[model samples]
Target: MTTSILTSFIIIISFIVKRIQADCQNNTLTETTFVYRRVCYFANWAAKRYDNISRLTPEDIDPFLCTHINFAFAKVLESLIIAPYEEDDLKGWTANSKGMYERILKLKETNPDLRVLLSVGGWTHASRGFNEVSKTAANIKNFVKNSVKFLRENKFDGLDLDWEYPGAKDQGAEPHSKTGYTKLVKKLSRVFKREAERTGQEKLLLTCATAAARHRIEAGYEVEEVCKYFDFVSVMTYDYHGSWDGKTGHNSPLYAMRNERKKFREWNINSSMLVWEELGCPKEKLNIGLSAYGRAFSLFGETGMSNGKPVTKKKSSIGIKASAAEAGKYTREAGVLAYYEICELLQNNPSNRVFWHQQMSVPYVSSKTLWIGFDNIRSVTLKMQFLKEHGYGGVIIWSLDLDDKTGTVCNEGPFPIFNAAKRELLILPDHLINKDKKCSDDNITITIEHLHSKMTKIKQSKNSK
Candidate 1:
């Protein structure tokens, strides 16, 4: 009970509080708060299907889960105007009479922070519309003007140009497509900026979904020049290899395999990100794309073998002799299956075997003659870790409909993959501190020291009495 002992106790408590505050400031012992974008694309076709198992309408979307939701496949017409690819997307005969566009905007009522952008020109629409529109300055001007007007009227936050490739031959692009692509983006950027200033509204975001492969990047993009005009770029990192190759391969490998073929070594997310970074794209302006679907193929060589095994050509196959497997129970695509469908296939069949590749950080399933490669929680976690370490801006889910809408597939809960990305990628406030657990011994020592000091004070007071 002496003044000196009391003073020492106060000093010790002050030191402990100061230490905790310092650790919090340094982001070592606690969560740190910061804003980051999580973009999810909602395909318009999802509303057309009426079946509960296969259909995923705008109402199924979790508005608060993403910072931006892109309404996909608003086509670019030959007349240089942006319009809905399907009439059903904009009009309905029901009593509600509200189409996909209106339904998506209604989500904002629940999550006011959400931003929706109209995504024009998907893989199918890009082949002709993009090439024609970007061919001349007049066409580009008309497209930009109509695009802004369309977005504003539809209650969209901005526009996302989903041109598959500008100079790629497969897409029917002309030789001048490279230069035309850059010119188009530049013009759109200028127009968007000017429109925002004149109307006294917030600057509308301008972004694009770009190719991830090295060859595609080289042939299609004036990478450095094109990236400067956009707010951000979503790199479509999935679909590296599929049934078209006549061989089984991972849909989206995180890293290139050690024994990969020379030609296929650069077909990976790592290589794509590196190529974009080397091309002068800022890390903060790049969002890596994730697929909620897997590429399915019928195996040729040894059935149930590990990935990267040699394959013999199957009869009646298309491009590369590998026959496309049957459509999934849900996705109903010949060579693809949604993540939920894949999970169901794995769970229902006890004979199906799963294999993981450490080098690529991906997983595959093989049973009898069917082989499928896909991303799961394990692979997604690794990708998120890489994104965090490499300073990437965020992630973009290709189409939210493909994920398990019902919580029955993965058993991890609704939107399992999306939830994993949000938890791993974002620097959320009030996250648990692992360092606090590590400091358990120190905490025990401090508690014991305080108890001893109290006992000493009590003994001293007794002696004085």
Candidate 2:
């Protein structure tokens, strides 16, 4: 009887605490004050194999929004909608149809300031769609006209084109894609800007997700002409070196360690910035890229890799899931590879060769199995600080879905990385106030007045309900 009574008391206390917290949240002026903080998460609905928009609840999208998070781009690459003469080319078409626009509109209604945009073209897919869509004046006109109608009908804030490349022509694609690409963007901008005026709608933002490798841009797209059509470009700076590169290095090196001196001399952030700036694009229009996840690699087996550890045993399998455990035996790992919230190497032993790179601001693990590289909170913070120093527009996350939804990674939620970037870069007026420092009573009075106004609004809402 005594235990039951204690339990009842605890439950009552919990209820009361919850009620107080809700009341405070409703009346807090900070919660009500609306400000447009510019940060965008690239959400790929069709590309994801498991996480689908239909399975997602309103809660799934809520954490991504607040006064600070003003924008989200639901990537609807048109290439996915088209058949690419491949078997899986039709794989995602059904799961990702035109209904994405409606789902995004629902998202916008939930949060007044939150806006959604559809992206077209992506790397490794639809290389030909760009050429097919832009090769002729008629095709360009149709794409632009239909896109304007689609945006208006669906109420999207803008559109982002993410064509991987135009000239390099990977796989079995066409050449002169760069030439046609420039004309296509020029044509689209002309129509989009004009339609906004005729309809009296607010300005529509035009942006692109571009390649980061120096050679890719110089060979593929005409950077100068492409910048003219876009308000800003998101440089995919990650994936610089991966298992595919056949070498061990950070996936996205901030300073290009392999060729740092040469990078400084010719191709680097400064040169990339110059390319866009010279094309008449404003500096503020450029946004860098960040990746929430990391890449893993496996090294050779039967090579006396078990240096001196027991867990350094080779895994009997491949893929990211087995990388950590399989790497346990070959204890001679060089870099740290982060998987979800667990690092197998770190858990087994901290003194292992695999460790964080302080200078490049990334993590990597070198093991007998293979050398792998990835990112962590420290690297993310460094990237954020870099953005602030450069005063570039903002940062773009490669994805929003892969983050651990349970909020376990880095002691923050899946989107914490992006949220940190906003706080450090945007400099909101509220955050500027030093909460620790004492302020005059006059400022306190003003804050109280605002809180009182919010209280009134809450009371009005309660009475209506």
Candidate 3:
């Protein structure tokens, strides 16, 4: 009897606490202040990485490190509805336990300012889902309804549509998909705005991962119109040049090599940004994509490779004959190496040369058999400065897992690349960037653990009764 009474008392107390918390949250989160966004993309599959240090779960994240976290990829179904791509993405990841969605949302407890968005579609999902969703007005309406419900039910702050290219024919995009794409975005924006007004909450943020190549952008987007609906456009500035070129090239050079052909010159960040501007997107609504990895090449005529690590003792600049480098040990992707792996190569080879491309404002590794182009702390700092100089909105890292996440490899510290970028990005004044931060988040700290504990106890009490 005493135990039952104690349980009842606990339940009442929890109920009261919840009501108070709700009131605080409802009144405290007013959209009136602003801060520059440091958007980090969380790759869900990183949990399966081969080793402890290489693997990352939500527990490994520093919630305060970024202003926004985009959970990389949920899928778009053939029925023109949204769905979780990974089986573990939905609730009950492992027999009634919280899944990736719950784990990531838990971050908000630590950082009330942090907004997490579910990113839908990726390269693998491609444009098919997008093309299908844009097939009709009713399809788009149903999609927006389902999408909004999903995001809200899951407590996501927004949705990031990552349609690779809306109108690229090679990607199997339906004709006039570009126009349809604009219509889709417009509808989402309108619905999100209306919902926010109805509920007295902030509107859900809408962003997109867009193509940086001039031709891609021109063909895929009705730039000025689309920009009006998106909170920001994350231009894919990396992968400007990779192994497919069959020659040495910078993956994301800040600028073109001096006096290059106009055709090739358009490949760099500087030119890409110019093209976006020419197409009518404002500089302030753009966030350039930052990569935490580099592209590597297998230089021709070099027998210097051992277990995927480059064995060459020489370095060459652009135009060196080469193909994609063997996949890095952990990343296991041909032509690509994580920042950590790049660091490992440098650390193992004391004689390896680091070339600072002054004009391109980036760095590359030189060796006889392989060449790698990636960003270091110095390079990242330069890129951040470039964002500020050009008045771009912010930076979006491709994935958090690719960085030296645990400080074991780089020895510079955990998340060295991220920290470097953060320091530079914070240089942007807060008041100038976002004005929706007026409410004090300090008063309300809602965490799933607390609620889950209460629920568990309530169940036990009922069973005892």
TM-scores for all candidates: the values are 0.81, 0.65, 0.82
- A best-first ranking of the candidates according to their lDDT comes to 3, 1, 2
Model 3 lDDT, residue 277, Cα: 90
lDDT per residue for candidate 3 within 320-397, as digits (tens), equals: 667899998898999999999999989999755788988899999887667888888999999898988888888899
* lDDT assessment of candidate 2: 0.54
Model 2, poorest ten-residue lDDT window?
A: 316-325
Clashes of 3: 10
Clashes of each: 0, 22, 10
The count of residue-pair clashes in candidate 1 stands at 0
Better of 1 and 2 by TM-score: 1
How far out, in Å, is residue 146 in model 1? 1.1
Model 3: C-alpha RMSD to truth?
Answer: 16.6
Candidate 2: which stretches are off by over 4 Å?
1-59, 63-99, 171-173, 258-281, 301-354, 366-370, 428-465
By lDDT, who's the top model here? 3
Instruction: Write the number of the candidate with greater lDDT, choosing between 1 and 3.
Output: 3
| Model 1 regions lying over 4 Å from their true place | 1-33, 301-321, 428-465
- Summarize candidate 2's per-residue lDDT along 383-455 as a digit string, tens digits: 7667656656667775554344345534565456555555565453454344333234455456556655655
